[model samples]
Target: MDGRASFRRIAAVLGVSEQTVAHRYRKLRESGAVRVVGRLDPCYLGHAEEWVLRLRCAPSATLAVAKALAQRSDTYRIQLASGGTEISCHMQTSDQRARDTLLLDKLPATRQVTSIEAHQVLRLFRGGPDGWHTPIASLSPEQVTELTPPPPDPVPLDLDDGDRLLLGELAHDGRTHHAALAASTGWHESTVRRRITHLRASGALYFGVDFDEHLLGYSSHTLLWISVNPAALDAAGAALARSPQIAHAAATTGPTNLMATALCSSADALYEFITTQIGSMPGIQTVQTAPVLRIVKRAALL
Candidate 1:
C-alpha cells in the first residue's frame, strides 16, 4: 500500500472494497504517522552529482548550522549526529562549480563549522526512502505485482515550468486529486491526468513513503561509513543492500567508499547487526557507526 497510491487498485489487490481502502488511507494520512510524497528525479532536474557532508561545529553553532543547511534548495536530507556537535547532510547539484561554491567557498566562510568533509557518491546500491526492500506492511507477491508502477523512462534535463507546479503539489501529496492539480496548474482535470501519466513515464517523478521507524517499533537508527577494497566495493554495497535492517546504502568517494543507514529495535540490535552480519561480510575493511540524534529535514520538505 505504500507504493500503491490508487485506492481502487489497492482494494482490488487486497480483496477489499474501494470504500474500505479509501477510509483506511484517510485515517493513516490524518494520523500524522505516514505520508506519501512525490520526489523529483535529480537526473531529470540536471543534477548528476550527489554528496554527503559531515560537519563538526561548535556546540553553540550546531543548531544554527543545521537550520542554514536545511534551507538550501540542493540539500535533500539533514540531521544532527549523536554528539550534538556534528551534522550530516545529503545533497544533489547539477554543476560542479556550484558544488564547489557551497563546499569550498560559502561553507568555509560561515565560520561556525570547525571541520567539513564531503563525500561524493559513486554508485547507488540502494539509496533514498523507497529504494530499500524492508516492508512496513507485508503483501503477497501477487498483490505486489498488481500494485507495482511501471519502470521509469528517461526525461529531458530541463523540466517544463508547468510541470514544476504539478511536481510541487505531488511533493506534498503523491495522490493529490486531479481536480486539485487542475486548479493549481490552470488545466482541465483530464489534462492533469495526462500530464501526470507522462511525467511518471518520463521518470521525472517518483513516490516515496515517509514514516517514523520509532513509531513502527524500530527505536534506533545508525549511519554507517564502511571502507572496502576497490575491487570489493560492489560486493560490500550489494551485501548491505540485501539486509532487511538497512534503510539506505551507497558507494561513495573519500576515506570511506560506502555509506549506509540502518534501523534497529534497540542499541543491542544495532550492535548485533554490525558485529555479526556486517563483520562477517567479506571485503569490508573498516566500519564506523554514528547514531542519529535528530533529523532536521527529509526529502524536499521540512
Candidate 2:
C-alpha cells in the first residue's frame, strides 16, 4: 500500500465516499490501531550496511537491554525472543566506523550481554520496500493493481538539508500533509511536493504501514534461523519468499545464512509451516526457532 496515497484515490478503489475513508483513517490513526511510516532502504544507500543482531542476555536484564537498544536510532524492530533471554533487532550503520563503535565497543562493553551474533544482511527477499502480503486477503486482484505504486527507479540521489528535514517529518508520519512537510523543511509546498516525487522516484524513500498484527488474528510470530548448504541458498531463499507464512526473508553472513520471520494464526500453524513447508525444502541442515515474546519497538522511530 502507498501510505502517501490520497484519501480520494483510496475511496474510489474501495467503493466508499472520500469523506468516509478519511474519517475511518483518522479514527484508526488516533486510536493507535494503524500508522503510516516512511522508511529508507539501507541497501540503496551507498555507504550503509544492514545487519541483524541477536543478543543473549541474563533473563532478568533482557527487557532493560532491549529498551536501551530501542532508544538508538540505528536499531528497529527490536524484540524479546527465546523466552526473554534473547534480543533481536535490525540495525543500519553508515560506515565502518559506526559499525565498529557499536559491534566492537558499545555492545561488548555491556556486562549483562552474554553473547552477541551479528549477521550482515546480504540480500532481502521480502520486507524492506517490497513489503509483506498477509495470508488473509481483503482486496481483489484488480483493487490491488489499482492501489499499487509504480516500481522505483534505482538512481543515485544526494540528500540536501531541506530534503533531510522533510524526510525527518515523514519518517514519523508518511501521510503528513504537504503543507506540514513544507513547514518542517522550510520549503514552499510546491518545492516539498517536487522533492518527495524525486525522492520516491530515486528509490531513496518508501512508505510502510504499521499495525497491530494480533488484531488481525495473527498471534503467532517467530523468527527462523536456518542453516542451508551454500549451493542451495538462493533456491531456498526464493522459496521462503514465496511462502505465505513468511513476513520477511533475508540472506545473511553467518552459520545460519537464511533468516525469516513467520507470522501465523497459532503455534500449531507455525509448527505446520516449519515441519511441512520449511522441512520439505532441500539443503536445510539445521533450524532454530525463536518465538518473539514481545515487541519492544516497531519499525518506525516514533
Candidate 3:
C-alpha cells in the first residue's frame, strides 16, 4: 500500500469510516506496533555501498555492541542472534573512506568484538523497495490494484540540499503532512508535494512499513547463510526471493554467497520451510541458520 495514501482512500477500500482508520493508525503508531518510514536507495547516492556485517562478541557484551550499532546513522536491521553471541546488521557507506573507517578501524578496535566479517551486497533479489509480502493475504485483487502506486519512471533524480531536508523529515515519519514537510524544507507546500512525487517517480525514495512481526503471528525469524554453486547462483537467489518465508535475499561476497532472512510462525514452520523450500533447491551446497534473538533496529531508524 502507498504510505502517502489519504485516510479517505484507505477507508474506502476497507469499508470503514476515515475517522476510524485514522484513529486506529494513530494508536498503532503511538504504541510502537507499526510505523511508516521513507527510505532512500543508497545506489542513487554516488559511491555508496551496502554491506552485511556479522560481529561475534562476548556473550555479556552482545547487547551493548548491538545497541551501539543500532545508534549509528548508517546501520539498520540490527539484530542479536546465535544465542546472543553474535550481532548482524546492514550498513551503508557513502564512500570508501567511510567504509574503511568502520570496517578497518572502529569495529576492529572494539574490545568486545572478537571477530568481524563484512559481506558486500552484490545484488538484491528481494528487499529494498520491493519489500516483503506477507504470507496471509487479506486484500482482494481489486483493492490491491486500487492501493498500488504506479510504476516508477526510469528518469534519474539528483538530490539537492532542499530535497535532503525533505527526506530527513520523511525518514522520521513518512506520513507527515505536506505543511510539516514544507516547514522543514523551507519550500511551499505545493513544491514539497511535487518534489516528493518526483523523487518517488525517479526511484530515489520509497516508503516502507516497520512493524512488530510477532504481533502479526510471525514468531520465528532466522537468517540463512547459503553456499551455492557459482553456476546456479542467480537461479538459487531468484528461487529464494519467490518464497513467502523470505523477507530479504541477496547475493553477497562471502564464503556463503547467498543470504536470506526467513520469517515463519514457529520453529516447526521454519523447519518445514528450510527442508522443503530451501533444501529442495538445486546447487545448494551448505546452509547455516542463525535464529534472531532480538531486533534492536528494523528497516528504519528507531
TM-score of each: 0.88, 0.96, 0.97
Off by over 4 Å in 1: 1-4, 15-31, 43-46, 95-98, 153-158
Query: What root-mean-square deviation over C-alphas does model 2 reach?
Result: 1.4
lDDT of 2 by residue, 196-264 (tens): 888888888999888778988999999999999999999999999999888899999987999999999
| Prediction RMSDs, each to the true structure | 2.5, 1.4, 1.2
Better of 1 and 3 by lDDT: 3
C-alpha lDDT (0 to 100) for residue 281 of candidate 2: 95
Rank by TM-score, highest first.
3, 2, 1
Q: Which candidate should be chosen as best, given TM-score against the real structure?
A: 3
- Model 3: per-residue Cα lDDT at residue 6: 91
Q: Per-model C-alpha lDDT, please? A: 0.82, 0.89, 0.89
lDDT (C-alpha) at residue 120 in model 3: 94
TM-score of 2: 0.96
Query: What value of lDDT does candidate 3 attain over all alpha carbons?
Result: 0.89
Error of 2 at 3 (Å): 1.6
What is the C-alpha lDDT profile of model 3 across 50-75, one tens digit per residue? 89999999999999888888887888
